[model samples]
Target chain A: MGKDQILVRVRDLHKVFHRGSERIDVLQGLNLEVPRGDFLAFMGPSGSGKTTLLNLIAGLDRPTQGAIDVDGQRIDQMSEADLARWRARHTGFVFQLYNLLPVLTAERNVELPLLLTPLSRAERKRHVQTALSVVGLADRAQHYPRQLSGGQEQRVAIARAIVADPTLLLCDEPTGDLDRKSEDEILDLLQALHREYGKTVLMVTHDPHAAARAQRILYLNKGTLSAEPIE
Target chain B: MRFWPLLWSSLWRKKVRTTFTLLSILVAFLLYGYLAAVNKGFSLGINTGADRLFLRHKVSLSILLPESYLGRIGATPGVVDVVHATWFAGIYQEPKNIFPQLPVDPERYLRLYPEFLLPEDQKQAWFADRTGAVAGRTLVEKFGWRIGDRIPLVSPWRKQDGTSTWEFTLRGIYDGAAEATDTRQFLFHYDYFEEARMFGKGMVGWYIIRIHDPKRAAEMAQRLDSNFANSFHETKTMTEKALVQGFARQIGDIGTIIGAILTAVFFTILLVAGNTMMQSVRERTAELAVLKTIGFSNHLVLTLVLTESLLLAGLGGVVGLGLAYWAIERGDPTGGVLPVFFFPPNDIVLGGVIMVALGLATGILPALQAMRLRVVDAIRRA
Candidate 1:
């Protein structure tokens, strides 16, 4: 694929964490390239650095050594404030636990990302309504997180992620906290977002069933990626 | 401005804790308001006529000076007129009903203190009747007294007839021209008091001298004191403001006392409010991380936290001061003890500034903590 078609590129990535004086290498000499509209999944054990790699690409974190370019921008070299602005403009995140503000209604939670924009209040409200409708949660807009079921909460979270129309959709075990039925529903929604909107998607998951739904799956072990599934 | 709702909702996240914290702030500011009013009342006399001087006994306010010195003071250069008043130390029926009762030459005292607004007809009546007295409007309201009423007071100093009771006809009720003027005094003719008193004849408490040019008051005061330098009753002379301030200092340094008390109260409030903000931020750690994930910069998070704290403090302060204003309007609850009991406009402005400062002080640490939170670590902990 052409360089312009590659939405995320990680070259010679290395991440090390320290606890007191001990050094822990989470990801070392890892490389990755995810093309636009590709649905990619990183499968690994709990300490295999799947989330770390995803965070570096999302500009939520910086690598110990490497280059992370997202949508042609060198995010690894960006300052914290610039990274924040870049993330707001180009990335959407869906968390496993549906980290919606308990004090805000579903509509308000969905409208969170739009507050950074200079959009009029009426325009923001319309955009929030459209995003909630896309996630099949338009009817539940006024309900608070406590009033919604786990699946519904995740749907609201998805609406919030897409409300800004970011270029890359990142999910970190988006269905990890749901029942099997709700898990399938979230996975289907992720699939629909990728297939219909042609959005670049990157997800980290340990579940084989969830990995099976992605267009490409890479297993991480010993701080490196492999095409073969982990035994 | 769009973040206001978010800040407000976050402030009330834990309703019980937020409510109790708000109440604590309210009570602190309420105490602040009342104490400020009390301090203003105690210092009210200091703001009176600057062009006037007081000539009193060199020893103490309780020591009497010869009444003959009033004429000498009035004859001095730059001295326009002079009046003398003696403290009666009298109470009406009960010691709790004690208020200032001064014996003065009615006409001269009225001329010296034009701020005491007495009707011309009543002034004539008071001058015509030797046993007539005039009560301030505040005193009249407190005792429900009216003109033509017989009022009796018991003085600590017994009369020549071995009786402590003194009777006078209420000829008038005088109002104050300014809000800060003391309207809790009872003024009676000095002739009646001097003729009936057992001792201290031909003596007065203090002489109030009105001068032509206030700029020359100090020089005139020095000149008057020299006139009695080596006499049997040596005199100490000072401007009216200084005399009132000296009297206040004799009781206590009211400003320092009020400052110390307010400092203690606000310090305790800062701790309470700071702890509350910290707890609120701690509970929202994961939520804050989510915000960061959605592109909220550290600076934005810090601003949100600080704004939340300011909103809480400002709300409590405004409400507390409003309640204090209402209570002051209902009048002083201490009977007639505090003569000038209204909250000063400057103090209200100071209260507003303190509220903002309190908000920032209580919020800084927690805001820094929120700002320094690493999104990855915070989410993992959550």
Candidate 2:
């Protein structure tokens, strides 16, 4: 799709958090456009607020001073419940540590997001199985988190993110906790999902190689977005 | 929601802690059940005690009234029949082997309660012989008293010439037809003790009046008491229930004390279980935060945590109730004091309700924390 078919559009977005005595500005007058099916990466230092901007785009948090439109809906103005339902229908998320509930097996962890929808048990099982198979962990579906290796757990997390058939996929330091080999494997999975399934992936990371795997790389410094050149 | 598997796995994770929690709930509910059953154990009106009421001398229970009063009281209004008795306050050959020995009029006593299942032939044989006695089933088993055998009871009050054995033949052993009273008392002919003639001459300790309508008992007691008031001896009459309860109250306010203890126990369980749920939810802060960021509604998260806590409590409650059932069924050290001891159905239901309430109340703190946590901070906690 063209840039006119942007999946995420932010206009002068700002976020401020209250910590005991004063306010801390995380995102200051940010702007961005993410087209449908584009693999994009946001690279920044620890306190640069890249994740804050992603949360706004994913409808996870409200921006204090601006508007965010994701797939034609202005999410900043939606009610918490509406935003949650919208996020369930439109957004998917992956984290560095996988964040899988230790108690659930791989398939059940993948099946978590589907529980929010009105899908039948069979439909849920099918979705979980397909997602796990997509991540090449179909055989590991019955294994608990403790039974899996780190990279395997992350792949399961990715499977969970996409199980709901969401429009936007968000990853926060998706390979920050993995070894180089595992990181490359994860980047490969992200690339495959983007290229084959045509998913819109917004990743935040410090690793340049991870960003190089994206169709576009953007830099965020002190709550402002800038361009980045990937080799 | 599909949270059951999550809860089950979480409970199974730390086996020792889970087991400890379950056991704690078990013990708590056991105490609750026993206390509740102790409350139920006070129900009287069975076998030996229910069918009889001691119409004591008007001045005091210990005061001996003349035999002439018994004939008159038996003919009073609402009176079906009457039996007169004197407490021997005896011990079996040994000083420590104490028991209540009663000198009773067998003929009229046999007419009062038809539920005391004794053979007609045995009753006739015992009533014909002056020195015959009928022991309760429990008493018979207790002392191995057989039919046509002699039981020598030593009375402390009616001793004569330093000898106290009031020997009587055990013509028959009887069983009570109700569930309440213990079958552990002894009954025999009063003429035997009176015929000894060494003590209590022409006098009876008390009279027991069996009424036709137990509901009109209060008025009957009043009539019985007024009939003998201001005489050389006076009578204090009461219903069989009131008399039994009065005897129990003489010990202490056990039911009230038990009620206070149960209230305290329930409060403690609520706090302890609530605190436990709070700690568990706190431990899952980051996970809950992740749920929020993934678009779980504040309400869903709140309900999820609360349900998790209640699930824990519910599981604990079932185990506790089960343990309580076993303990009560097996009996306690209070041995036969709580004979009808069992947890009431409502108590188990109450436990369920309290578990849900305590779990929800405690979970609210952690859930609110989760709902209020900044989404950015939540994910940042990593």
Candidate 1, residues B243-343, lDDT tens digits: the string is 77776698899989999999999999999999999999999999999999999999999999999999889988998888888888788877767777998
Q: What docking grade applies to model 2?
A: medium
In order, the first chain's TM-score in every candidate is 0.98, 0.95
Q: Write the per-residue lDDT of candidate 2 for residues A158-199, one digit (tens) a residue.
A: 999999989999998999999999999999999999999999
What class would a CAPRI assessor give candidate 1's docking? medium
The residue pairs in collision within model 1 are none
Single out the weakest 10-residue window by summed lDDT for candidate 1 chain B. Answer: B1-10
What is the Cα-based lDDT of residue B24 in candidate 2?
64
Q: Estimate each model's TM-score.
A: 0.88, 0.79
Instruction: Give candidate 2 regions above 4 Å deviation.
Output: A1-5, A19-24, A119-123, A221-231, B38-54, B58-223, B239-242, B259-271, B332-364, B367-374
- Listed per candidate, the RMSD to the true structure in angstroms reads 3.5, 4.9
Global lDDT of model 2:
0.78
**Native interface contacts retained, candidate 2:** 0.71
